[model samples]
Target: MSTYEIALDSKAREVEWNNAKCDKYDYMISVFCGLSAGIIDAFFVGTPGKGRLGQWTDKTADNMVQKIANMLWTGDKRSSVDGRPKNAPDTLEKAISYLEQSFPVNYDARYGKDLINGNAISGMSPLNHHLLSLAHSPDIIGLLFSIIDQFTGKATFINNGKLIRLVPVKDARNNKVMYMQGTNFESKVFCGVCNWLGHLISDLCGSSSTRKVGKTGRGAGLPIPFYNLFLLMDLGKFDSNSFADIAVKIFEEGYDLRHGAAMAIPVLIEELSIKVIWALKQHCYAKKEWKDCIPSAKHADLRMMLLIGNATLCLVDGIDAAIRTGIKGGNPITFILHLNLVAWARLVMLVFRELKIRYGSIVDQAVGKYLAQIGLNDAYSLKQYYERMNAIDQKLDSVLRDFTFKVEDDYKVFIQSLNYTLNSSLRTPEQGRDVSVAIAKKEGVKSDRIFRSQEELRYWLGEKK
Candidate 1:
């Protein structure tokens, strides 16, 4: 049997790509020409099914819908992918219980943020839709979304062959995966992807540019943010509409319904419509809490990772807003965070947007170099930025050593790989769109078709020429 149908996945992905030129997405992974956003590296995609294993491998994608409805009937945790082990925690309470057991701390007290605690049971992959699984298990819900997001634009009808490819798990140890750093999926990525990102981050900022062009760097297996976020959106973190809003909106504060990479910016843009600039300034200066959250005399390195913790924390907070709003665009914090997103936080949004537009797509190779240029050209200071980043790198390594003791050997191995990734990715946050475009030509992708019509959605999404 084959199942294929169009269904909303996480809104975050829908929102992000909604404004993307349709030609880029539907045509082939390669046609992008780096005109849009993000690169495609099959190896960097996170674990298949994103913790939600779909059994409809025959392609009819429809098999899982009935199975979704029947989750409580048989309570099977096994994957349809050739006896890969039943991978879900089973039941909403059980999932939450796993989180509790994993973290061994109060969860709900943090206003539903316990899922992100690295040491908690909630760390079952820092996804927000965990609550969506409250009616079932996060694993089940994650699977349902995996089906929709993967098949949506690609599906022709219900129960089609597209279902067979809906979920593609990570190789886990491929060590050559790639991804973006300084974001949430940072620590959770595969080692291969980490190597690419780390190298990109470094080349973008580090002194070596010409020599590394034709050579491949070491592997770390980090997850790809471009694809990872796509999966997150499929699971309902953001929708096509939100993605559109993200493409257009700058950054203020509002009912942040949009998902994708623009969550923090759009909400701040709409909610703080009256005072967008002021609000940006505030969040920029908001105190980062890495020191507060993991306060301990463990090591100078562990405490050091908290250097960029403020920026990462800001992204997390904004993403949280996206999750709570159903990626639709409603919420009071949009009203509250209006007057305070200044300084680095505000700068981060603008810089991030520019980078995405300029060098974010597969066609952009100069992107990283552009970022390095920006860092070097900054009127304020690149020296401090470099120092902080170096310190943060050291700190990250220290913490990795400390936490590996608590998890399984597999997880420990995963963390061990983070050393290079952390060092490579923290190179710089800015890149030139030109540089990104240049480099995109070399790395292979699936196709060369980018839906040019989708560009219209960018205007609606706030992307202007």
Candidate 2:
């Protein structure tokens, strides 16, 4: 295994397990190895009794924030500055410099038979992913969110401020097709992830990086509230069934990654939920802001984390639709994996809460019966839930084993697409500089996918011009 995978394995091992420890390991490994392709595969294969909700499917939107953040660490050109490469984002100017270099400016000259050599950007569709799988294509590449691009010199910026990743693709083709590798192209998941991460101190290596480079806040042309800290509430402390619902509500109110690393919810609350809730109470959360600040208004990053986490809850409202409608043919596999992982995580928390709320006699009665008689009074519901959890957990382990690039091909495809788009060529040889971006935009999106519109593609690539 590579050093990166090993380190991730160790970290995964260290994390405590509630449902299935092994499966959790697989999840983490997949995150580092290939972005969870196995989960997607399994969902499409249709395990057992996987029910549907109604009309919607996984075609809506994919929250690839974690993957984007991870790419930042990989140093895509989107994270580089003019004078400062991603491999080194020391001073505030360096960070700012990197952002300016990536965000695409002139949309007019993009469309043509070939890319402008260096001007190609990727789209955010599965087609780019498909091409990334191609073996002998020079059009493949990878990208990074602004976080990791601290060392690479290419990352994107919003106007003159707000540094983040435009998209971390590895190739010119990916740039042309994938809409910068962003799912919510118009919504700004790129900047949101960057601004969200900015609220904390990630690479504390030294004086150069974002560790402390800026005028307290607002480095480069970055926004004033780009990294401001704000705390909302701790859901774990609440004693009501509405807590989760309330949490979801807060997420809808726009607490997205703009506010904190995570809300100081109880450890149990974090464990029960389906999504990964990064705790900010210890290492970085309490240390910096909450150390001596007031309870409600202390430590800005934590507040922002919570804000984002909370808002994310609301964003996931379409789960019911996805489950009900069933996944589309083009995206069936991926949607299944995403839905399962997300749903399982959410349900786990809800179940745990139910256990706590209906405690005492119910617990004693059920377990006592199970210990005494196999099927007497039958606390069958409890037994069933446990049994199902075990099965799912086991399945998670199996699915996770091959979810990444080394185990699967989709990951490599995505990586390759990324590489194809980020080349420093100001123009293309085979396809003429004008045609380069036209081809790139197409590379990111596949005509087969459900969401992308050809008109929008034309507008972005200047085909409309």
Candidate 3:
């Protein structure tokens, strides 16, 4: 002791802070962090154990039902041992109280007010920036859903009782309630599976010309209307029929979903029902917009990253209608039909990508040379390039103008090709029955595996020509 006059290390300050935080969440650490030291447990340690930790690692199919039940009903309770420290949530009752305190009953009253008042909790990691933990702990599912229910209320501005609106959580910019972004697990599962099946069909039938070939540009994520789709699903309005049928109905209706993209012309065609055609048209239009808004041909790599955000505005009528119709009443065939519609959209995107690539290559080969001749460099900023172009020789100007005309013509070709494909695919018995019958009759004899008989093929094609 006399020889040991060692000074405290500078790193002790960080250690002390970590120790304090660990002490605060000791119970949660014990329940979730396995046998790691308390300091190591403050942040997620991704260990193997029971209770909070078990759900993350245990993937046995048999345990799934029990896991779900636990998430729905179980409460966190810590064990009392000679060596372990006792925290406040020492029993199931206390655990419930602890959870409630941590998550809160009203989102708007607590976190919402803070966000609206410009005092939202800061220091969020970009990747996992969720305010509340919705992972691992099954109790969190119950807690979050319960919070949602508490926040849900009648709209004061319109359709009071008829609409069970979620209370405004953040300050409305133009007086509107902000809804949650991202599709819930239910919708994701449904849509993801449907998407997979659609892809499978594309692979087998070559329905889609290319696989995931587009940049998916800015504003390419699910539309604001799609967010409401999730909200409507959360409301538990859709009927108890098959999930497939519900998905189909939603796609067919198109729900008047918002469309966003750069350059688009509304496609009109007489084929299937007007609603189905409209959905196809919107899909094309939105993709067109996405293609146009994305960075230009020179900066194609920049298009790889997507910036996703949800609309703060919520339409009461949309939510109300979803609840009313979705609660019950949807055709089972709708999902299959919806998949076909999505298939068509996928083809359109692939075709668009091909056109973009082809045109971009042409520009790079021909116009790029002309631009370099006129002192244009790929390294130059768009503004710089534009200014230089304005000062180019009249002959060079004509060449640039001709290049632009070619690009526009290419764009027109892109739109027309997609429109033609859509018309051909969506063509109903009434629109192209004669052609379909001839094609089917010729192909039917070749595929006894698909068509049991010529008669079956006729019914399948909806014609007997």
Candidate of highest TM-score: 2
Predicted candidate 2 versus true structure: per-residue lDDT over 117-192, tens digit per residue: 3233332121121111111011112122232332222333221122223323333444333223333322344653
TM-score of 3: 0.19
Spell out the clash pairs found in candidate 3: 237-326, 237-327, 238-326, 248-334, 261-289, 261-290, 262-289
Model 1: worst 10 consecutive residues (lDDT sum):
37-46
- TM-score of every candidate: 0.17, 0.23, 0.19
lDDT of 2 at 2: 100
lDDT of each: 0.29, 0.32, 0.30
Candidate scoring better on TM-score of 1 and 2: 2
Decreasing lDDT order of the candidates: 2, 3, 1
Report clashes for each candidate as comma-separated counts: 129, 117, 7
Quote the lDDT for 320 in model 2: 31
RMSD of 1: 31.0
lDDT of candidate model 3 versus the reference: 0.30
Which of candidates 1 and 3 reaches a greater TM-score? 3
Q: Give lDDT tens digits, candidate 1, residues 199-256.
A: 2222111112211234332111112122122222322224343432231121111111
Which should have the higher lDDT, number 2 or number 3? 2
